[model samples]
Target chain A: MNILRFITAGSVDDGKSTLIGRLLYDSKSILADQLEQLEKSSAKKNDNGEIDLALLTDGLRAEREQGITIDVAYRYFSTPARKFIIADAPGHVQYTRNMITGASNAELIIILIDARQGVVEQTRRHSIIASLLKIPHVVVAINKMDLVDFSQDVFNNIIIDYSKVATQLGLNDVKFFPISALQGDNIVDRSEHMAWYDGPSLLQFLEEVPVENDTNLKDQRFQVQYVIRPQTDDLHDYRGYAGKVQSGIFKKGDRITVLPAGISTTVTAIEIGGKEVKEAFAPQSVVFQLKDDVDISRGDAFVNAAEAPELKSELDVILCWLDDKPLQTGNKYYLQHNARTIRTIVRTLEHKIDVNTLQPLEITSPVTLNEIVKAKLKTAAPVVYDSYDLLPANGSAILVDETSNSTVAAVLFR
Target chain B: MSAYQLNYLEELEAESIFIMREVAAQFEKPALLFSGGKDSITLVHLARKAFAPAKIPFPLVHIDTGHNFPEALEFRDQMAKEVGATLIVRSVEDTIRVRKLTEPKGKFASRNWLQTYTLLDTIEEFSFDACIGGARRDEEKARAKERIFSVRDEFGQWNPKLQRPELWNIFNGRIHKGENVRVFPISNWTELDVWNYIREEKVGLPSIYFSHERELIEHDGQLIAASDFIRLDPEDVVIKEKVRYRTVGDMTCTAAVRSGANSIDEVINEIKATRISERGETRIDDKVTEAAMEDRKKNGYF
Candidate 1:
């Protein structure tokens, strides 16, 4: 069985929570005791608590009181064929940073919409953000179909509007499904009311989505986490480079180049748990032994020299300001890319994105909280990397303020 | 190693190694919270894998309640020596004498909660910036919300709302001087995944993890192993049974289950078929309420 991780984002009342609740309830993922508790809580009358499917979610008590999701709540459920991880994020405009944090590693983004309202500002905002974050798949779940009498026209209209926005961005794998989460239609099972629709159910689509090839496999990059040296009598001369295979495949006798030093060596062995393995691939943790000593240490990248990534001293990044403080221009911040940290300056703020319109606001000033902007960065030293479109692990970085040691922003190099 | 395909276990192993390195690189003084349990034993093995061909750089710190299983104590010393890592023992008995923690005058009363005070004292004594634990989210509800790099305040209190947002592969381990981070490398792993990984990695755990014939007493719908620390009641009759511990903790609080899972494979298969959670069978503290684990977490019980 495969594992799929997705993030759901929309406005507060756009039926985002209802959709997830419906999926969990319909799939028999909810425990019997938990459902009984939910039923009891829903019956207790107070501000939409009665029969409020949203109550099934919104775990935090404070979130329930405020009637909003304040943080990213992760939920897991598995069907026979695949397992699913839902990074349920807050939908408020103030929590856009939270959405980015939740959707960073997500392979799919579920953008919910109300059929009665067609397409709204928040819908376009989240879709654009998902595209910018390079989410591989986007499912536009047109929710609240029951509110619009389960009208196929209402669903079709929203799809047309969303298509225009999705085209402006580079998201071609966008899918649409009309779902009545309150009535459990077109979510886990097909809706009889929407006979005009001929697509798979939302759960079926999620299960069948192709996500294995999402990671870049051409560029074989291994960032040395730690250099293991044992002074034991049996293995005194042993030296192993410990790290995860970020991309591509590594095997014995593969010629690899160690970054920051650029010395080439052949792979002698790959060890997982004190034993040698024949091969390792992306997302696998295995220690590598080089045929020759190349002075590799922690924070060094090992790559195939023939297909090596570009080493750069500066990068133009699309950054989301995460901290509460405004990102000051011309400020020096430490950029953590992989294991290495280098001091970098905010060279130029190209444009601050207007969340509502998805338009670039050409600004030279500082970016405030919950704002996304493109900026040029100049690093103190050259670091090995790749384009975001090519390899996400090597392409992305984060800015940390050296003075306070706070993560100020998450940067995706363009 | 390459003959069989264990993709899920391998992914878990990869992520755990990444987290282990992050703790080593991010914290000033990091230590492993070893409790001589299967989970901690698996963690020690992963730590060895994370730095293969070298000894684990971090020291192992165990907050002994002095009510531990005798087999667990012997296993702890042997594993620490095998890994060649420094082991520091802090006892709740010390705190019970120095702070005069009240002892309950009952047969089943345990010193489980007193270990928290002793653990906090150990952190203060060592000034450890990060404490690596083998806690998995699938253990209980409260653990599900834990961040990979969890921060505790100066008083060692966990405020879930104030947790820092952890982005993709970027963990922020910065905290105040008095504050420390509780790092769980296996936070996403489940109990089945742990046993499967252990089986595949050939990690050696204590012999107590295997099924053995032991004297047991029935209490609170659980099968409690009779130990030296446990006093028998007049009505509570002792019977010999074949049992194994699902989890190893304080001898008084950790219960045993009727099982014949002597090998890791049998243990994994048993866990797969078991309807009750690991904590439900072993941890007495978790049987109180759904929020019991959360409350303990708030009070700095790791």
Candidate 2:
């Protein structure tokens, strides 16, 4: 079975946890002992005389006590068709950076909407973030339908409203499902209550959604994570550049360019698990030997010399502020991309995007926690990267504060 | 877009290797926390695959509780030598003598809590900046919320609130001195996935993982192996049963399952059909409190 990494984002009252709980429950992924513990916790936490499904994702003590997810809690489940990794992000407005963290790796995003409220500011913000992250698929689950009497008019109206936001955000691939997460409808099974919605359940759609295309299989992008050279006498001449194929495939004879230094070399040999492999595709960890002994180190990328990504000192980036410390222009931070961390200086703050209207707003102050801003960055050294939209795996990076050593911001190369 | 894609297992392997490579490249001094369990063995396998032809760039450190199965200890020593990795063994027995640590007193008393002190000491002793663990998010509740590159203070306390936002494949391993990061390469792999990987990779495992005849005592409906580490009470009845360990924690804490599954294939089959979670079925430590793992992690327990 293939893997599907996804994110679920909605406000606390939007039944996000209930929806995840329903999927795991229906899929028989929850074990008997876990169910027993849940039953005990539900009795103590829930006064509604029913199991508290939200308790499943709220794994931390502080989160369980406050009834708020403090961080992104990853949940795993599987069926015969697909294995899923759910990045359950908190919905508190201040936790937008956490959602961005989850959305960065997600192939698909499930944006929940209150059936009564339709599309709200939170939905718009989530959609905007998904678009910014370039998540391949967008699924809108208009939940709490049981309260709405499974009204077709309400569902259709919400779809119409969301589609406008989707169109504005350039999110063309969007799917809508009407259900009640509390009542276990339209999550894993068909919602008999909403027969007007004749579509596969959310789980069905997730399993079938083509995530393979999300991986860039055409442009060959690879980074050297480590240069392996055995000091043993028998294999004295072995110098292997070990890394994963960030995108596309690398054959033995492919002429690739070692980035930053821009040295040209041919992949003399490819070995996976110490065995010779003719070609290694994207996401496969393999070791490569070059014809020439180039001065390649960790963080240096290798790409097909013909269609190589740009190597520049200045970069345009959309920064998702994550740290409590505010960011100002000329402030220096380390930009960590794939395997490379380069000394970078913030050149200028262009503007911040108003999440509510998706409009460019001038940055009147230093960017603080959870604020999204567009900025220009200049690296001390030449950096090799593709635009985030063209190649996300090799393009996206994280900004680290040199003082606190905290990941300050999520940098999306533009 | 093309149709060439990797299966879930292959993908998990690739992700793990990526993280392992990051540890090798990012940290000045890194070491693998080898527990001699299936998870750590799988980690060793991945580490070997991560830097093939060349030896793993880091050492394998094991914090022995002195209450482990003989089979597991044997396997740990043998495998470390076989892979040409430097094995650093720090015992809680030594930590107790030097640090004057008071051992817990009970029928199920263990060095599980005190082992943390030894681990922290070892970290300082070697000045290891990163400790690559085999902890999986699917194994426990608190681990689910932990980042792949989790930071800890000098005291080895994990601050959940202060976690960095881990975005995409980019990991920020930058940490201050006297603090170390716990890098979990298999943070995404579940128990089933590990078994599937082991099967596919044909990685060797300890003998205790398979079925064997052993003396076990039933307590609170859980089967605990009768080992010399524990003080047997009059009420506790020891019986001989064909049992196998699901997890290889301290002998004072880990329980066994009644199974005749003598091979990896049979073990996998048993695990597939089981309804109980891995910890719930075998571990006696986590059932102590609702946030047992969280509390342990806060104090630098792996």
Candidate 3:
């Protein structure tokens, strides 16, 4: 089954958690005892004897008491056709890091908007981040249409406002749906309230959407995870290289290059779970036995000799600052990329991006938390990597503060 | 290898292999947590594939609660021999006998929670930097929030609020010397996914997973397997039923469901029609509250 990962972003009271709760509840994903406990918990919070479905997804105790989402709460549910992983992120401005983390790998991002409030800064910020993260799809769910008397004009107006924001962020494929998450309209089933809107329901869109080709298959990237030397009488001197194919495909007899060493070899066999296979493709964890007895270890990558990426010591990157402490110039930290890591220093701050306006500001100092900026980093050693836009699996990196050992920023090569 | 796109199970296998390799490369010393269950067995299989021809690059750690099924113990030994990986077991029974821990009372009581102490002691003794387990996020609520590389403090406790921001495909495993990481490559897998992957990969499992005649007693609306450890109350009634375990845990807490799924295909079909979740039918501790798993996780229970 195809897996569709999505991130949900909206204001605190925009009914994001309630919508997720309803999805889980209506789909029969919640177990018997879980629903029973939810009923009991709802009864205590019921001012007018109505079950607040939000309780099912809003897990944090403080978030439940405050009736707001505080962090990214990941929820998984599946229909027969497809599986869904929802990253329900917080809406507070301070939790922008959480939203970035949630939407980083999302194939689709559902940006919730209050029907009454046509478009707000939070909505634009989410759209900006969705674009910055290169999330392929965007669904603008104009929620609370019932509160606006199910007026067609209200929904149309919100769509127009969202389009303008989407345009500013260079989002090409943005979808709009008017939904009343509380009333279960235009969610799982078609809504009788809006007969004029002829788009497929949210569930239908999710089921039929093309999510299979989201990964990059053009670049053949394989990071050597471990070196296997089977010391047995039958297979004595058997040395195999094992790891997952990050992208593209590899077949027996294909010419492959070992990175850092620039040694050439031919694939002899592919073994997945002890069985020999003819070939391997992206996302398959299969061990490859090469023809040549090359010296290889962990933290090395194998690639097509013709299309090997650059091995460089310096990188220009767009970084999303996630730590409380600012990224000071000339500070050394660990830069982890794929299976490799090395000490990296902030060479210079190029420009700080205003997420809302997409404007770059020149800063002589370091960038702080919740800010996106472009900076130059110099590593102690050369690292093999691709542009994040080309191969997301190999392109991305994280900056860890050496002193605190905390991940302070996510980096994308520019 | 085939013309068709890689299926979901294949994808999960690839991802898990990637994580296993990361653990070996990033950590100084790492161990695999083996529970003799389908999930852990799946992890062991993936680890083998991740470093084929090279003995798995790490040892297996089993925190024995002393309430295990005999079949599980036998299977664990056989699997270790077959894979050629060293198996290390730390018993809670020894911990209790030596006064390192106290045993709970009554038939309903369990040493499951106390196993955390034994596991911590084993980690401290071995100085393992990373311990990979077969925990799935879709299995419970608290697990849903766990990162692929979850860092535990020197005390072995998980702090959800202070968790590292795991972004993109990048996993940050850097931690202090005392702080260790709990890695779950299959954290995103569901129960159905596990079964499907097992079938697709043609992975071998213990015979207890298949339907067979077993003596069970009804207790707290659960079909607990009748064993020497279980004390029969006057109100309890035993019956012989053809049953299979959906999940393999301690014999006392893991329940058996009436099934005729003698094969993997039959098990898959049965699971599709079943209305209850896997934990709902198999786990006893999860029945107590909605936050049961979350609370246990916060207390350093894996």
For all candidates in order, the CA lDDT equals 0.82, 0.91, 0.85
What's the candidate order when arranged by decreasing DockQ?
2, 3, 1
**After superposition, which runs of candidate 3 have C-alpha atoms over 4 Å from their true positions?**
A362-366, B1-4
- On TM-score, the leading prediction is 2
Which scores better on lDDT, 1 or 2? 2
TM-score of 2: 0.99
Which 10-residue window in model 3 chain A sums to the lowest lDDT?
Answer: A58-67
Arrange candidates by lDDT, descending: 2, 3, 1
**Could you give candidate 3's per-residue lDDT for residues B73-123 as a string of tens digits?**
889989998999999999988878876556777886778788888888899
- Residues A29-121, candidate 1: write the lDDT tens digits: 665546655676677635555566677666555665678887777767667777677888889988887798889879999999988887888
Highest DockQ against the true fold, candidate: 2
Interface RMSD of each: 3.6, 1.4, 2.6
* Per-residue lDDT of candidate 1, residues B78-187 (tens digit): 99998899999999989989998897557767888778899999999999989999988656545666778889987788887766767888777767678899999988
RMSD of each: 3.5, 1.1, 2.3
Question: On a 0 to 100 scale, what is the lDDT of residue B13 in model 3?
Answer: 71
lDDT top scorer: 2
Kindly report which residue stretches of model 1 are placed more than 4 angstroms away from their true locations once superposed: A21-59, A191-196, B1-6, B103-110, B202-245, B255-282, B287-291
